[model samples]
Target: MIGILYFSSTGNSLYIAKKLKENLGGKIFYLPKYSGNGSEFEKIILVTPIYSFGMPKHVYDFLPKLDKSKELIVVQNYGGMVAGADYLMREYCTKNNLNLKSIYVVQMPENFTLSFSVPKFYLKKVLKKADSKILAVVDAIKNEKYNLPKKRKTKEKTYLKNMSNWYKIGKEFKTNENCVKCGKCIGLCPVGNISIVDEKIVFGDKCVACLGCYHRCPNKAIVYKNKKKKNRYINPNINENEIGQDI
Candidate 1:
């Protein structure tokens, strides 16, 4: 059986995985909830969002535990650009003796509202592009297309340097008085880094910096260093419960 495993914060990766499941016969499994040794499937497709040109911390932690013997296809959904993330995943698989089959990158709407605003027109355009890209990827995977890592360019190198400070990102997230202590952030944090203390939301050091809580907040009350300038983005095709983190 084909197994599609994914780690998604705001549902881009999850949406892609669901589409793949519809085109190809497979069962979708959330990476954060997966605990098996990965022996349940004959083939595996791993999907995740690129965070600051790198893989999420939870994806990094979960990679070593995956079954290296199975045929593997890796897909990364990116908002802006995917720098060395593909190379990094390839290196990890090589070192772990995993049978990496193929890798593809899909461009999705940028949901990182801390830095800039994603206008509705631009978001719609990117989402349309993402759907087309996902179809191509599905076709390639169906045909068993194998690929090697591309030559790392100078731009990718620069992105890697810039994203190197990703660990310091979540520390700047702050909530305003508009917060009603709804506890959504506490539940939607993928790494369980958010909680309630003294009836207020608290962030812990274990944050993976996925931005799930900030984007998914009903009140749009969570801010990072400053207030948000754009509207919150959740995949228009996906429901809140479909992507909600059950922490």
Candidate 2:
């Protein structure tokens, strides 16, 4: 049996997990909501999106709990450099003695609206290319290719510095008059970092910086440092409701 475990904020990693399941035939589990250690599954595929060029803190915490004997495959979805995380995961498996089989990094559409411009017009072209890469990746997984991680030259030190700043990012979140108290962001946060305090949304300090709340805000009310970017992005291949289902 195969189990696909994934952590995604804006649907990119979830989309990749679904594509793998379509060909590989496995049950899917959202990592945040999942309880067990996955002992029943013989093969396990872990999918996650890169944050600060590495794994999300929630995903990193969940890694040690997985069944060590199971053959492990890692699929990382990224919108930018993956070097820090590629080395991090490989090193983690080596140190922990997990049955690490393969690792793949797939480029995804950017969802971090507060920091970068995610142009809607370019999504189609980007998705097309990503789909092609996903197909190739699925084929490789099925063939037992066992493609491993390679050291790619990147600013890993910069990534670490950025990660340190991510902890304080939620402190910058504030809503504008456009907020309707709809509570959508309350459900979208994987870390439960957003809440309604006296009928108004308030951000907590546990933000993992996935940007799901920022991008999926219906009214464009949620912003970092009182600035909402003109464009927000959710994966074109998946809907916001589906992404929120994990919550």
What TM-scores do the predictions have? 0.90, 0.92
Positional deviation of 185 in candidate 1, in angstroms?
Answer: 0.9
For model 1, residues 116-137, the per-residue Cα lDDT tens digits are 7788999899999888899999
Off by over 4 Å in 1: 153-167, 244-247
Report lDDT (Cα) of residue 131, candidate 1: 89
Error in Å for residue 110 of model 2:
1.4
Report the backbone clash tally of model 2: 0
Residue pairs with colliding backbones in model 1 are none
Candidate No. with top lDDT:
2
